[model samples]
Target: MASVNTLPGMAPTLAGKTAYVAICGLGMAADLADGLEAAGARVAIITDDTSCFASRSGVEAAFAAVAERVGPADLVVHAAASRALCGAQKLTSFGEAGFRCADTALRATLYALQAAHGQMAGRGGAIVVLGPAMSLVGASNLVPLVTATEGQRALVKSGARQWGRCGITVNWLAAVSELFAAELAGMDPGGPELGEACALGRRPQWAMDIAPVLAFLGSDAGRSITGASINMDGGEWMTP
Candidate 1:
């Protein structure tokens, strides 16, 4: 893990780099960790929804796998239990339960940001939050998620402004997909809708496709870019 492992022609962008934090604990985060390691950067900590971890334990196990390759991280990515996309109508209909859900998402992101910023105080590092496009483009049922995700975006901007001086870059990536089974998918409030809403007749993005952008944001190539929401959704939304 310490050695600079590169292919015959593949250059290392994060080679010998140190420190990174991953929140959400999804397949994307796992892929990001792999990309970072391949670039020679080591992940320091990871956090995710505890229930999700407890349900399958695969998420936590992924972090453990990374630790085996690289050294331990300082902070974990603890994600707050919240949906990805909450519509405006849903927000209106949301009672205490809705607020709680939204709060979880907001608090999770904030906690991760706080932890990562604190760890990077002296030496400096990178922080990437896994976000969805609906967070920026709010729909009817995406109220709770929209509220929380909006706050997260704002936090990213503020973090960049406040932490850039410390050499810590704060950024996030948004992926668009109808096939994702996460609660934040925003396609339905009932069950997972794999591909019933695609007007363009294209397959939803796989988690792997978005990993590189996140890796870039966590790498040297994204040093100058902070407090920005980079989208990895193939032409889904581009208002950012």
Candidate 2:
């Protein structure tokens, strides 16, 4: 594979590595797969199209099949969270959609982490969970998504602590919505301005801005860094 520079001074950090990306249908997932491949990591996609995320056993079996096809993965990227946008009403509304959304996002992520951990038990690897930064700042109509993403962040920290001895590193990347620009275009004329809300006064470049961070976390360079949340949403939200 031809080596491409994923970041300055990195020299193809993922060279010769194998990455298994879940939820390939998402724009972020597709970008991640492409970026990983460009950096010399062989990529394999795992999605619900062929597997069910409704149960732990199903998720485990799906990952097992992927492992059989790709040998052992050096990095597992879990980008399977729900992207359904709903208002606060949905949070308090008596409906199964909210429950199902949370179930798919949180449960699927947990199962992916477990499956990856099991596969890399003795030998170590990296697990990157892609989440929304909106969870950090909180949004009016995204309660369920925020709950699941924040919960996933907490799980990453716990997983890092639990699996440190096994050499596994778990981290979360909080990204801006890939649809930010398009959504802004459809915003009401009287709505708040997107640029003014962000300190940087601009939205982040969807995949290009995030892929390098993933490459670093999945590489040996980031072995010392784990149990952390890296905010990749430009200056939308700041944390000390």
Candidate 3:
């Protein structure tokens, strides 16, 4: 039911490519994996939230094992939700726990990049970070998640700039988190009101609206777009 294989015309031929789906949340990770697989990439999924935040060596080891089990990763799609529901805290109530939530997100992202770079550095590949649309527009009661979202965005740009010479592209795709059911809310909270729809006048469908975009980004056609923060919010939140 995901969007990857349902698209018309020639699908991206990621033949012989090894891709990693690293996610903290479970909403669309399975669908995304199916999408990549439909496009011909050998996919490995890393859903262990604790391994990434625990220590440097652990993440490196975990990632290395995956590459060995499958093959060196040619692409990585990441979404950060490192803890159980790391969002929806009132600003006045924000505390050390809030900071820890933010830290987990940042730490997970950095590890993803570091591990992906270790594998893709000399070989050259793509790294796509999935973010929450609310990060583009501030959301109430989600200050920490927002902070981590933007922080990850900065990392994307930095990785793009530094890794461009190596043929590695880093970009962030801000999706409509509402579509992922309850699984993605920890990363993306405070969605629009019932009446507040996108410019397109509706919420995006995962298979119909969003998955196709990821298919494109993971393909060779999207090589030119790097260090970009694209909001696929059904135009609900337009970037000014």
Candidate 4:
């Protein structure tokens, strides 16, 4: 669905660098894949909907589709997630069903990350995970999401710590703003002033805004930065 542009003499600078992205939500998967390609990196994608875990076959097909144009290298972004937003009242009143759904997202991401990590360890590459900003604070109406977010942060830290020595750097792309712009399109979206007392009173961010940061973290420039959670949100959410 994405169109490719020819740049006469300007081949991609990051071309031939191969990267596999899994669990891309909505259209962001395709967007990130295309960005990686523009940078000269070969890209392959696998969504959770595929039957075989990370959908290795799907990724292979992507590589084949662009094989003649750009070669492949090494990198993977493991990010499979489902809506785990359960109103706090329900979470506290009911049992585990809601909580389980939320927890599953973290586990799913871990499974995909581990699979990708194996391949990266074999080739020495970078791993990036798409994490949520809700993980940074407690939203009374959204307990399930909060749990999953925090759990993911923990996973990123552990993954980076264990894999850093293997020539693989793992980190979380913590979005300081709402990366889900499409969903908020007709909602008459408001700025941080709406939630000032709760968060740091900052504005939400678009998905495109977060893409560049993710691309940077997955590049060689971010090679030395591992096990760190980089906030892409404005100064809205800060530590005291």
RMSD of each: 6.6, 3.6, 2.9, 5.7
Write candidate 2's Cα lDDT for 1-240 as tens digits.
Answer: 123244453357889888888762244556667777766677887776756566678777888888788777889988655544333344566277877776667887888888888788999999998876667766554556667778889999999999988999999887765333232223332332221256766666534556667878889999988898888777766753
Residue 18 lDDT in candidate 2: 82
Give the runs in model 1 whose Cα sits over 4 Å from its true position: 1-11, 19-21, 25-27, 49-89, 177-181, 184-186, 189-208
**Tens-digit lDDT track for model 1 on 62-128?**
4455556664443233233354324334555677767776776676666666655555678666776
List, residue by residue over 94-178, the lDDT tens digit for candidate 4. 3776567576666666666666665665566777777655567655544565677678878889988898888888887766435
Using TM-score as the measure, the top candidate is 3
lDDT, candidate 4, at 226: 87
- Per-residue lDDT, model 2, residue 21, is 84
Tens digits of per-residue lDDT, candidate 3, 90-184, equal: 75676677888788888888888898899988888889998877777766667777788889999999999999899889999888757543653
lDDT of each: 0.54, 0.70, 0.74, 0.58
- Model 4 misplacement above 4 A: 1-13, 24-27, 51-73, 84-89, 181-208
TM-scores for all candidates: the values are: 0.69, 0.84, 0.87, 0.73
User: How far is 165's C-alpha from truth in model 2 (Å)?
Assistant: 1.1
- Candidate 4, run of 10 with poorest lDDT: 180-189
In terms of lDDT, which candidate is strongest?
3
